[model samples]
Target: MPPRQQAQPFAKDERVLCFHHEMLYEAKILDIQPSEGSEGGYQYKVHYKGWKNTWDDWVPADRIRKFTEQNKELAAQLHAQIKHLQKSSAKVPKKGGRATGTDSARVSEERSSGAVAGSRGPRRARDYDLEQEDGFHARPSIKLPVPDHIKGILVDDWENITKNNQLVPLPHPHPVDQIINDYLEEERQNREPNSAHFDILEETMAGLKEYFEKALSRILLYRFERPQYHEIRKLWDQAGDDGPNKTACDTYGAEHLARLLVSLPELVAQTTMDQQSVARLREELVKFTTWLGKNAKNYFVSEYETPSQKYIDHARSF
Candidate 1:
């Protein structure tokens, strides 16, 4: 029930008797948490009337909202709708050899109901994981290897690219690195004046594939690696004492905005340090920093520049 009259602001520690959870619940801001691990949003601690501790619960600022009696009615209506949908969907025979509908719901039902067998696997063939998973974090699929006949001509193609640039990096001792180096070196040795231009093109493609695969992986892992909420809360709590990197952790992303006007300086410092601590920062930067310039005139830079697998997968495949 909305208050009969006005209850004025319930200042801290002030209280009155409330018979029901519904009567006096409105979203009131607690405090903005700056150092919590999250991205874009006001990181708030809120008090909502709907919580287990409705009178005094701290929730993410985005999560706080008013509760209504109609919520149960809405849920019941949705359940009824789902049941009707399932009944209509069940009419199609489970014994049908193929399919009757295009919806994923139907497709899922067919699979569960044994309408389709396991024999029909994925249709569009994919190569392996593009990020080498084990260590190199390479692509997960097989690169279409140039056949031995084309391999010879492709070697010349690589050397031709080499002349335009400088010497390629010598392969490191790792078996994977060595294999890649061997392929490139062999191509250089056997380059005919008339090496098949297409073969060279493929070799150049191989170089591109390596760069893109690593660069994309590094970007993905860094961006989604963690959120700012809990991390910030912990650091904020700790900084009240003393913790290393406290200044850096509280600075970047959502941390920048939420903590409070007074605490903004510390949060800013944390953000800068957080960005600097990005894993393998320099190595990741080097991988594809020059890629745009190298392939400025070409199409499909994303595809061609990504190391298709380089020597790592070829070694694995062989």
Candidate 2:
């Protein structure tokens, strides 16, 4: 009989489950394999219960036990029906008996077909060849015909090769160059090119391209040297908090520099302000700008117009 499936633990072979009743259990089949000789299918002892420790019966996979809308009484009736089925099969005529000749002939034909199928014999399976397999996404496959062919040969002069220890990251050399030259060959073979690897490739190419662009730009920038100087100073001043050390040499540069110098004292005074002074400044600044800027403005506003996102992330974490 097949094993039953329930909300119970299921193991291999012991397919029966008992939830509907103690005597009547579920027989959800675990397997439908042939038994020891050529008699029929095999039912393994997956779980144990009822009549003995366990009972083995060779049954088909379609014969799984279930308990949908079933209870103790229905379960017992199902079990009785299965037991009757087993006994009724024994009353059939012997396989070679005159009355069972038709059944006997069918069994012989099946056995004869199976014997020819076996006599065809087994052949050796081919080994998994790396070259035969397609590379992922049509990428060039790593060609490593010989491991010992590559051992030691330098390529790029700027490249750093590790000696049993590599704390710094190094760039991947052209695969053929490494493989043919016998340098970083093992690592070259292991390196796989994916989306991230392609991104890194693009970034590296961009950096190399930028080197040439800047070299050309400096040659063409000779005409606007003074104006470019002023622009650069402005950017420097903005970066340096418009301080005394920052230089200015263009129109309205003096006036802007004066305003910056005047504001310097207020910025310095902020560090010394008591709570009362801070409150007063916060109020005055709010009235002047129509906004106090931020809660941390009084102490450090003119330098930083707003608190950094780092502070927001830290506050959010808390």
Candidate 3:
């Protein structure tokens, strides 16, 4: 027989058509693993973009081909058709509430079940904690360990936190209250009957503070589990007691706990971190820092940004 055509080298995220069951499905290459046997070649781990995680799989190079311009155009047409079908079939929302129907219900079901579409064999833990038994055994049905508190966060929490009533207001002795009170007191002493004129001012100040604090707290929560936390923890731990990490930790009185909290989100986010996770992380950080003292809390949250932004910018450059 004549020589077979060589498979084209595809990079991660390149579009491709993978043969599964007897059909070709659109997928994106997630990883390329090199072959080690007598017949050297490669295999690909691909994510089926249209079918959700259930359809993700690993296949031999023979099973995949680079997606062409024709394939791209066809895929776009299919996507348009799907969206049209969904709009026509979806149930409209009642009154002021959200739309509910088969599509929405299916999404909710998929989230709760955490079931992948055509998933097979064993699943790997999101955070590979080798010391744990679940991490050691590669069971086909095994799931990443998600904390009870965060399961909802990893899925539906994003929708919940976006609503107007999502974040609860933190109790006031509010951070900026002293200045507001001082202004109000000065107005009151200026004239006994001046209270009425200054009432609006006080109310405005109070409202601004409430909203600011609420947003700030929620913002912190959203960023809590960002990947940057992982890098920070690793560096901080290796620096011992006299470096920047120790100084920051000792200054905040949180010691290594600070590093852990920062890193905790990285692991959790892999399994459960979403918009809701970020919101909750911020709220919790605010609460944690408040307990640590106002000045210390301010310092801790401020320090997180430099490293986090640095990591994000660096990743984007690549």
Quantify all predictions' global Cα lDDT against the true fold.
0.28, 0.29, 0.40
RMSD of each: 26.5, 37.9, 25.8
Model 2 ranges off by over 4 Å: 1-48, 67-73, 77-318
lDDT of 2 by residue, 1-318 (tens): 544332222235444544211123555444444445443334344332332324434433222333444233344443443344345544876786663222223234334434210011112142112222211112221111111111111111102211221111111111112211232232233224442323433343343233222322222111212233345556656768544333221112211211222222223243554533332232222221111112112211121112245533442342
Name the lDDT of candidate 3.
0.40
Candidate 3 lDDT for residue 170: 20
TM-score of 1: 0.16
* Deviating ranges (above 4 Å) for candidate 3: 1-8, 70-318
So what's the TM-score on candidate 2?
0.15
Put down candidate 1 lDDT per residue, 152-179, tens digits, no spaces. Answer: 2233323332233211121111222223
Better of 1 and 2 by TM-score: 1
Report the number of the highest-TM-score candidate: 3
**Which scores better on lDDT, 2 or 3?**
3
